[model samples]
Target: MLKSTTPTMVEAGTKTKKKHRTFSLNAKDKYYALLFLGPSLLILSVFVFYPMLRTLYISMFLTNTLGKTTVFNGLGNYTDLLGSPEYIASLGSTLVYVFAVTILTVGIGLLLANLASKRLPGIGVFRTLYSVTMGVSVSVAAIFWLFIFNPSTGFFALLSNMVGLPVINWLTDPTMAMWAVIITTVWMNLGFTFLILLGAISSVPTTLYEAASIEGASERRQFFKITVPMISPTLFFVSTITLIEGFKSFGLIDLITKGGPTNSTNMLVYRIYKDAFYSGNYAQASSEAIILTVIIAFFTFLQFKFLEKRVNY
Candidate 1:
C-alpha cells in the first residue's frame, strides 16, 4: 500500500466508516406502535375472546335465575337442546337457510363476476349499483325487505297487480316467510360476493382464455373448464365466507321474520339473542351461544376437510 503525502493524513490516519441500523426499539417508535395496537388488542381480549371463553364456560353449567346461583349442569343444556322440539326445529331451520343462501350467493356471484370480468359496456356503473347493497347494513336491509315483502300497501301488492301475479303475504305466511328472507339475504349479499369473485377472475391471465377460445371451446365450456379452475381458490374463500355468514345469520331472522309465523325461521343466532335479551335466560342463552359456536366450528372444519382441499391454488 502507498501512503498519501497530504500534510496531516497518512493511509493509516484516515478510514471510511459505514453506518448501520438495528431493530432495537426506540422509545418514540415503540410507544407509537403500541398505541396503534392497544385498541385492537384490548377489543380482541375484552369483547371477542373474553366473551367467547365465558360462553364456553357457561355452556357447562345449570343456573337458578330466581335463586341467583349457577351450578354445574354438566352437559344437561346440550342434551336438553338436542332433545327439545323447538331447539331441534331452530337448528333445522338454520341449516336449511344456510344451505339455501350459500348456494344462491355463490352461483349468482360467479355469474356476475364472469359477466363483469369481460369489461362489457356500462359494467362499472352496474357493479356500483349492484354492490351498494353490501354496504347497506344487514339489519337495515332486512327491515326494508320486511316492508317490501309485507302483504298490504307494499311493493309486493303493487307488483302483484302490475304483473297479475298472486298476492303473496310472505312475512305472515309460514310457508312463504323463510323463502322471502332467504331471497332478500341473497340479493343483499350477492354484490359483495360478486366483487370478490371478479377480482379473482380478473387476476387470471387473458392468454389462457384466448388459447381456450382459439381451441374452439364454447363460452360454457370455457367457464367450467378454465374460469372455474382459475378461480377455485376464490370460490373456496367466498363459499367459506358465505357459510360463516349463513351460520351466524340473525338480522334477517329478527328484522324480517322475527322467528315468526309459528317459528318457521328460528336461526341459532337469533334464538340465542332472543333467549338472552328477550326471554331473560342468560344462562341458557350463553349455553346456546356456546353450542352455536361449536357447531359453526365443526362445520367449518368439515368444510375445510372436504371442500377446502379442492381449491386449485
Candidate 2:
C-alpha cells in the first residue's frame, strides 16, 4: 500500500538535503588545498622548472667568458657538440663507467644481501662491515682510497712488495685511472645497495623457501627460482638508483683521477664542469648538459619500461 508523506516528513527530508549540501565544499576547500600546495609548487618552480628552462635557453646562445650571453646559435651548439671528439670520448667514458658501476655494484650488493640474509651466527657483524662504507663521504672515501693507491708507504704497495709483485700506479696510468674511479664509485655506492636489498630480502616470507625445500629443490635452484623472482622489484629499484648514481658520480673521479692520464676517467658530468667553469664555454656546457639529461632520461625510461615487466608486484 502506498503511503502519503506528511508535511513534517517532507520538511525534515529537505532539511537533511540542505545540511548535506552545506557541509560539502563550495569554494573554501579548493582554496585550502591550493594554500597547502602553494609552497611546494613554488619551490618546484624556483628550483626545478626555472633551472631547466634557463639551461635550455642558455644552450641556444653563445656566452662570453665574462658570463654574458653574446649571440643566438639555435641548434648550432648541439650540432657542434655531437661532432666534437672530446665530447664523444667523454660520452663513451661515461657509458662505460655507468655500465660497470651499475652491474658490479648491484651484483655485489645482492651477493652481500644474500649472505647477510642467512640466519647464521655473527651475520650481523658481516652486515655491519659491508654497510660501513655508506657512512663515508664521497670525497673522504676517494681520499682514503687515494692513500691506499699511493705507490710509496701505501697498503697495496706494501702488500705488493711483500708478495714480490710490481706495484701499480693506480692513479697515474691511463687504463688504471678509469679502474680506480670505477672501484671507488662501486665501493662508495655498495653499502646503500646492500642495505636496500637486505631489507627487501628480509621482507620476503620464509615459508616460500620451506615450501621449495619440501619439494626437494636445492638451495641454488630456490635462490634462482624463488628468492630472485620474489625480490625482482627491489632489484629493479637498486638498478635504477645505481644507474643514476653512476651518471652523477663526479667527486670520486675528480678527486682520484681528475679526468687524468689522458682524460681516461672524464665522464659527462666532469666534462660539463670542465667546459663551463674551466673552459668558460657556458653555452657548450649547457648544450652537453641538456644532452646528458636526455640520455639519462631515455635510459631511465627504458629501465622502467623493461624492468616493469619483470617486477613481481
Candidate 3:
C-alpha cells in the first residue's frame, strides 16, 4: 500500500511541474509579442490615431487661417456643408467620378489581363507596354495628359484634323473637363490594375482549362466558368483598392483641372484642399475630411459585408 501511494504522489507532482513550465513559456511569448508590436503602435498613435482625433475635435469648431479654433459650433460646419448647393454638387460629382473610374479601370484591366494571359509570340513586350504606366509618377502622367489634351497642337488636335473633326476643348469646357480627368485617371491606373489581374489569371490551374477543352468548351465559356471564379478574390481586392483610390484622388485634379473650368471636376478631396488652404476655412475642411473618412469606411464595410461573400477563397 505505501509503495503504490508514493508513486501516485510523484506522478501528480510531475504533472504540476509541467503545467507550470507551459504557463511560463506562454507568458514569455506574450511579453515578446508586445515588445515587437510596441514601436508600430507608437507610430500609429502619433500619426494616425492622434490626427483622427484632432480632426474630429476641430470639426466642431470654427478655426482661423492658422487653424486655431475661435468658436465652438458643434456640427454647424456639417450642417452648413450639407445645405450648401456647391458642396452637394461636389459630393455628387465625386461619387460619379469614383464609380466611373472604378468600373472602367477594373473592366479595361481585366480585359487587358485576359489578352496578355494568352500564350503568343511577343506577348512579353505587350505585357511590358501594358504595365509601363505603373512606373510613371502621377505628376508626370498628368503632365503627359496635359500635353495630349492641348486644344491646338496636341495629339488630339492632330487626330481631329486627320478625321476632319473640329478640335474640341478637352479641359476648358465644363462637361468635357470631367471626362478629360476621368480618362487620364483611368489611363494612369490601368497599369497597376492590369498587373494585379494578370498575376491572378496566371495563377489559375491550367488543368481546369484542359478539362474544359476536353468537354468542347469554347474560350468564352471556359473563361467565365473557370478563370473568373478562380480569380474572384483578387478581383474583389483590386476593385476595393481602386474605389478607395478614386475617392482619394487629388493630385491629378490639382495638376490638370485645378478643380475645373467651373468646379465641374471638383472632387471631395480637392474641395477639402481648397477649403483648408485656399479659402482659409480649416474648420470646414476638417468637417469635410471627417465626412470623407466616414464615407470611405462605410463603403469598405459594405464591400466586406456583401462583396466578400462572393470571393472564392
Candidate 4:
C-alpha cells in the first residue's frame, strides 16, 4: 500500500509540472505576440492617431497663420464653416465629384475587367495596358492630362481643328472644369480598380459558368446571375475603397484645376489644403479636415451597415 501511494504521489507531481510548463509557454507566446505588434502600434500611434487627435484639438481653437493657438473658440470654427455659403458650395461640389468619380471609375473598371477576362489572342497586351496606369503617379497623370485638356496645342484642340468643330474649353469653364477633373480622376483610378476587379473575377470558379451554360443561360445571364453574385464581396470592397478615395481626392484637383473657375471643382480635401497652407487659416482648415473625416466615416459606416449585407461571402 505504501509503494502504491508513493507511485500515485509521483504521478500527481509530474502532472503539475506539465501544467506549469504549458502555462509558461503560453505566457511567453503572449510576450512574443506583443513584441511583434509593438512596431506597428508605435507607428500608428505616432502618425495616424496623434495627428488625428491633434487636428481635433486644433479645430476647437482659433489659430494664427503660423498654426499657434490664439484663443479657445469651442465650436465657432464648425459653426462658421456650416454657415458659410462658400463652404456649402464646396461641400456640394465634393458630393458631386465623389459620386461621379466612384460611379465612373467602378463602371469603367468593371467593363475593362470583363473585356480582359476573355480568352482572345493578344489579350495579355490589352490587360497590361489596362493596368499600366496603376504604376503612374498622380502628378504625372495630372500633367499628362493637362496637355490633353489644354485649349491651345492640346489633343482636344487638334482634334477639334481636324474635325472643323469648336475647341471646347475643357478646364476654364466652371461646369466643364468639374467634369474635366472628374474625368482625370476616373482615368487615373481606373487601373487600380480594374486590377482589383480583374483579380476578383478571376477568382470566381469556372464551374458556375459551365453550369449556367448547361442550363441554356446567355452570356449576359451568366454575367449577371453567376459572375455578379459570386464576386459580390470583392465588388462591395472595391466600391467602398473607391468611394473613400473619391472623398479624399486632392492631387488631380491641385495640379489640374487648383479648385478654380468660381470654385466649381473645389473638393473638401483641396479646400482643407487651401485653408491651411494657401490661406493660412489653420483653425478653419482643422475644422474642415475634421468635417471631412466625419463625412468619410459616416459614409463608410452606411456602406458597411446597408451595403455589406448584399455581399455574398
Q: Which candidate is the best by TM-score?
A: 3
Model 2: pairs clashing at backbone N, Cα or C within 3 Å: none
lDDT of 2 at 143: 84
Local distance difference test scores for all models: 0.82, 0.88, 0.92, 0.90
RMSD of each: 11.1, 9.3, 9.2, 9.6
Return whichever of 1 and 3 wins on TM-score.
3
- In model 1, state the lDDT of residue 45: 95
Candidate 3, lDDT over the whole model: 0.92
All candidates: TM-score: 0.83, 0.89, 0.90, 0.88
**1-313 per-residue lDDT for model 4 (tens digits):** 1334697897786687675643344667679878998899999999999999999999999998677999999999999999999999999999999999988998999989999998899999999999999999999999999999999889999999999999989999999999999999899889999999999899888998888899999999988887788778778888889899999999899999999988998889999999899988898999999999899999998988887777775
Task: Compose the digit string of candidate 2's lDDT tens values, residues 1-313.
Answer: 0013476676685687675544455477679878999999999999999999999999999999797779999999999999989779888989999999999999999999998999999999999999999999988998899999999887889999999999989888887888888988899999999999999989889999999999999999988898888899899988998998799888888888878888888889998898899999999989988999999999998987788787774
Using lDDT as the yardstick, the better of models 2 and 3 is: 3
Model 1 Cα shift for residue 58 (angstroms): 2.4
Q: Rank the candidates by TM-score, best first.
A: 3, 2, 4, 1
Candidate 1 per-residue C-alpha lDDT over 1-313 given as tens digits, one digit per residue, 9 for 90 to 100? 0112363453223332122244455678679889999999998999999988877777777656552337888888888888899999989888889999999999988987888777778888877876777788877888788778767778988899789988988888877888997999899889899889888999989998899999999999999988898899789888888999998887777778788888888789988888877877777888788888889999888877877667675
Q: Which residue pairs of candidate 3 clash?
A: none
Q: Judged by lDDT against the true structure, how good is candidate 2?
A: 0.88
- Among all windows of 10 consecutive residues in model 2, the one with the lowest summed lDDT is 1-10
Regions of model 1 farther than 4 Å from truth:
1-43
The model with the greater TM-score, 1 or 4, is 4
